[model samples]
Target: MGNKTALYDKHQEMGAKLVDFGGWDMPIHYGSQVDEHHKVRQEAGMFDVSHMTVVDVTGTDAKEYLRYLLANDVAKLQQKGKAMYSGMLNEDAGVIDDLIVYLMTEPGVAGEWFRVVVNCATREKDLRWMSDQTASFDDVALTEQPDLAMVAVQGPKALELAKQSVSESRATLIDQLSVFQGLESEGWFIARTGYTGEDGLEIMLPEDEVADFWQALADAGVSPCGLGARDTLRLEAGMNLYGADMDETVSPLAANMGWTIAWEPQERIFIGREALQAKKEAGISEKLVGLVMESRGVLRAHQKVVVSGVGEGEITSGTFSPTLGCAIAMARVPSATADQAEVDIRGKLVPVRVIRPSFVRNGKKVFD
Candidate 1:
């Protein structure tokens, strides 16, 4: 048995197929995974994301500490509630984890605060690493918010239906939240963020309040989704999974994360700055790219990718895209790889076309 979230009983009541994910008992699906996926794309769906770790960094030195901690400059976040996606890297330029950090207060102001949300699978290691990095900063403090529960309400109608579930005041606040921004109301943090590549809100509230709120959203016609659908949705959206897409052994340059690294203010030294500079100077050997199967076969992780005369690579994350009606994948291949390749499925070589990593966004095909 693994740890259970606040909605464990509710999931059981809904007949969710439970599976152990990163030592936590999580719902894989309620009944049909495909239906849940379609529900989110066509209408609205809610997911229990309480298993993710949320840590609040506050104090006088919060900004300075984070500037040194994340590859992306938090100094760029001049407005409160603004968010930036960043990769926390190691000294070797290897990706420790990719996370979203929201500036809770205006930059350069006293008592500036930042909120970081990391993946559940790397929770323990990430916390330990973060603590070690911040040990030298006496004025910085890290507080883990285990008492909070997070739910992501996503899709076209997600925001509208979600507004009906929250307080009237919060609904107004939600209406004002811009993309990649967040606001707090009535002790709940509502962020205009999601993993499904759709417009939605990720709400974090008191653990005790989540069940009722989730139930309210369901009653309001939002479908209850599970991790199984979440995976497919994110894949279609071209979002990277923590472990499957990249890990401690991979550098951001090779992981389709180079854009997240802030290079300006060149004097500001963050972790892995030296290694990343060296990698940049030496030229990256491999790059992460998108693959679409032209032949009739499913693409999956660990499948060998043959880039003709270039070199071999492997699929990092692949799936039968429900929205695209075909197989799509993200793979790490030689930087010289062209627009065509072949994937080794079982013993047979299947033809695939290489393109930009994104397949679909906002229910439309993004790549040709």
Candidate 2:
């Protein structure tokens, strides 16, 4: 048996097909992945993201330390309850992990603090790295929130459904939350964020209470989705997967995550900044591109990508997009010939059209 989240029993009751994902027994699907994908796009659905790791950083130097540790500038988040997405990089500017850090409105005494959520697969490595980086700092204390479980409610009506599951006092906070904002109330840490290309919320509550909260949302008509739908949904939304899209050997610029890097504030310095800046100045030879298959075949990872007259590339993440009704992929292709590449489907090399990602957003198709 693998590790189980707080909603393990609930998932079993719902007839979910559970699979081991990064040591955690997670639901791959309930019944139909395509139907679940469409549900999140058209109505509302919830995902058990409890396998993710939550860490809290507190101290006088928390913000200062983070500013130097993360590739993105934490100074950009000035308001309380605000969150920022950033990448932690190695000395080579290669991505270690992409995470969301929340600037808590109130610290322990009710002022404010910083909290981060990292990918489950990189939990141990992330903790060790974070600890090592902050070890020299006298003012910071990093603590993991192992007592919590995360549930992401997504879709057009996701916010409404999530708000209904919370108490009146906590529910009011949702009304004032801006995008990329979060807050802590009672034992719940609710954030106005999601991977689906729809406005929604991700709530972290006490592990024991997770099933109850999920039941409440389900009673309100929110479908419980699984990892299969989550992957396709996030891919369609142009989000990157840590392992599939990027790893320690892949830099942000090469993974189409250059936007997450902040090069401003000439006075501030962060780890891997020099390497990244140098890479930018030298120009990246390969880049992540989006692909739409013109033929009848599903794109899979590691598929060969051949440019008509150029070089080659490889599909990093691919799937049959339920929303687009076709196969879509994110590939790492030679920058010299990435515009229009061909994918090897079956034994034949099929032509594929390349475009910037974000294939679907706000329940609308963004790509042709």
Candidate 3:
């Protein structure tokens, strides 16, 4: 037996195929993974994301503490509810984890608060690392919000359909939120964010109310999606998976996350600054890129990529893109590699085109 979310029974009731995901028994699919994937792309689908860890950082020194903890500068968040994606790094410029931090209070305000959502698999290590770092800061406090359950409603009609499940007041708030922004109403926090590269809301509310809320969404015509579809959707969107694309051993720069680093205000000084600065000076030897297999056969992780005259690399994440009707992958290869490469599948060398990692956005293909 594994840990189960508040909606575990609901998933089983819907005939979901349950599997162990990072110690949690999660739904892989209700029936057909492809159908669930298409439902999100064509209409609305909801996913139980309560397995993700949510932590609240509060107190007078909260802002200062986060500025030192994340590679991205939280000082750039000028408004409350604004969210920023960042990479928490180690002293050696290696990625500890990638997360989203929401500024919960107004800028330059006392009693400042911030909400951080981290990968469930890295929850223990991340909490320990955060605790050790905050030991020296007496004014800041960290509290894990285990009482909250999160649900992601996504796709073209996600916002409209999700609104039917909440109150009219909450619906209005959800309609007004901009991309990457969030707002709290009636004890529920709704954010205009999603993993599917589609317009959606990730709502966090009291755990006890989640089952009823999920049932309401289902009644409102929102399809119940599972982890299998979630993986394919995020892969098509070119989002990095925690353990597959990068880990404690890999730097953000090599994981296509260099853009997440805030280099200005040189004095802000966050963890891994020294090592990142040194890497910048020395020049990065490898980088993450997108691979398109127009040829037959599927792409899978750990597949060897040969860049003609350049050195070899490996596929970090790969899948058959439902939207593109082809296989796509993200790979770490020699920085000098050009637009062409060959993926070693089994014993055969298959030609592939290298491009930017993002293959789709807003339900449309972004690559040529």
Q: Go through the candidates in order and give each one's C-alpha lDDT.
A: 0.93, 0.90, 0.94
| RMSD values, in order shown | 0.8, 1.7, 0.7
**Tens digit of lDDT per residue, candidate 1, span 1-368?**
99899999989988899999999999999999889999999999999999999999998888889999999999999777998999999999999999999998766777789999999999999999999988878798899999999999999999999999888999999899999899899999999999999999999999999999989998999999999999999999989998999998999999999999999999999999999999999999999999998667789999999999998999999999988888999999999999999999999889999998988888888976
| Model 3 lDDT per residue over 278-330, tens place | 99899999999999999888999999999999899999999998888889999
Candidate 1 global CA lDDT score: 0.93
CA displacement after TM-score superposition, residue 159 of candidate 1 (Å)? 0.6
| Prediction 3 TM-score vs. true | 0.99
Task: For model 3, name the residue pairs that clash.
Answer: none
TM-score of 1: 0.99
> Least lDDT summed over 10 consecutive residues: which range in candidate 1?
103-112
Model 2: residue 50 alpha-carbon error in angstroms: 0.4
Candidate 2 residue lDDT tens string, 1-368: 99999999999999999999999999999999999999999999999999999999888888888988999988888878788889999899999999999888543344346899999999999999999999767788899998899999999999888888889977898888898888878878888998988889999999999999999999999999999999999999999999999999998999988899988997788999999989999999988989998678899999999987778899999999999888999999988865577888777888899988678998898876
Best by lDDT: 3
